[model samples]
Target: MIGRRGFLKFFGSSIVGLMTLGGYAFGYEPVVRLSIARYQLTPPGWTPGLKLRIVALADFHACTPWMTADRIASICARANDLGGDIIVLLGDYTSGTDFVTGHVDHRVWAAELAALKAPLGVHAIVGNHDWWHDATAQKRGAGPTFSHKALADVGIPVYSNRSARLEKDGYGFWLAGVEDQLALRRSVRWKRQFTTGLDDLSGTLAQVNDVAPVILLAHEPDIFPTVPSRVSLTLSGHTHGGQVRVFGWSPYLPSRYGDRYVYGHIVEENRHIIVSGGLGCSVAPVRVGVPPEIVVIDLG
Candidate 1:
């Protein structure tokens, strides 16, 4: 039906089109940011005049070549760009089984990661992926896959069922973090046998100052339901904002909390919950409508 000239024209156009799309796909800036969440929480000691901005980075499944040390540097630079007084990483820093294969160099990555800095400081917590390995093989000071020491070495304190005290402008707050629900649930029997004490939110809360507003840095957003109202704000990352929301709806959110909280800010009773979409995709490398995110939250 088509002549030779028409066929050639069409073929050439198709090639050009494909090349254009390929360029975009493989471009150095292929990474797209989904959203920027902003919120204000007033700590109890509440001086109306003070303001502190905190940037949150989470779920960096860095196994794929796409998430390189350069990419992490970019994220840190962006956080600095956002005027963040402090930076927080919600975990899942590495992806795949590098510890088993011995193919991934975590120490090198840690050295590169140490470059990230914020005025107040960088804080972090472990995620499901970080702990989904054989713990018995770990060396002391080496957190699951060397996450604990690596992050600590980078000046980012890794909180695993622990608490830290922070002070800013004469105001202080207690930051408490707990193990991920999925990880805890999966390792219930092992915890009992080892007597290591399973994740106890109640015990973690006991460490906080009752009067000051407590900020919780939990890896999984699913833990919000069980969290008591005593907490002022909860920072989390795990859902990846459903990863692939279509028309504002995500079809494959595997979280127990489900579609109700694929991403963003949610207020519960007296608690403020912020679910960061995270920096990298999990299970698969492709991301559709839901792009990655770095949450910037302000506390006054």
Candidate 2:
């Protein structure tokens, strides 16, 4: 029943008030066109003179608008700006929305992502969200094609407890990626087993030879507790760094160890873990203190 003038005044005031409360306003925008952050990782046996810059992108629950093709294109454009030696995409690529053949249509956004060229290429790992979306549902034969293959089809190799070697500036390091713990939880818990070909933390670690500095790609930070000493640095993305965190605290965390494993760089003995906030929203579309992120890690 409100007139146009009255409605305008009320809605405008509400938006302004929300902004004051740390929420985005009607015209709200990020100061940094893209939220770019940096971290330095010093791992033992790290390739000397490596100076490798890695851009880590994660938790992209590709559900159209939120992680639209355009957004992904923007991400690629930005990563190219950094000129990182390698690009690492730590999983959670799809969300609740079902896909065709258990995977998002790679054709929709793959080219843009592939546009991001790195000497070592782009690597990925599955996340809890990926498992929930990829595996067969209770009543369904197969949900959709939302698995790692989606990325692989576009030339991005999604590693599940696998090792890939990358060399930069004549120095090389081992890039190890693992599957989500939740995906392997069944075997780990009841069967005391593992999904065939899935990443076995111990087995994957054994492949690296411990001679080269290893940078592990683990989608969930909780895997940190289980990682072997062979890993010198681990990059993960499941926490989204508490996607909606406030003052460095999240309402809940799924880390097997605890929330302390939620964000930033952590040093456990000789292993260093860096948890990226990621580039897409999951579960909820809104992001508060935890802005979507693109992390640039320099390994020297």
**lDDT agreement with native, every candidate:** 0.70, 0.70
Spell out the clash pairs found in candidate 2: 100-145, 101-144, 101-145, 102-144, 102-145, 102-146, 103-144, 103-145, 103-146
Q: Any idea what lDDT model 1 has?
A: 0.70
Instruction: Show where candidate 1 strays beyond 4 Å.
Output: 1-35, 41-47, 96-104, 133-145, 184-198
> Candidate 1's residue-wise lDDT over 87-204, tens digit each?
8888887763242222235666566667667777878887776665426422231244467667777667777788777778777767788865555223454543331323568888
Candidate 2: regions farther than 4 A off: 1-16, 19-33, 96-104, 135-145, 184-198
lDDT of 2 by residue, 57-94 (tens): 88777665456667677777888888788888888777
Model 2, residue 150: distance off in Å is 1.5
Q: What are the clashing pairs of model 1?
A: none
- Give per-candidate clash totals: 0, 9
Best by TM-score: 2
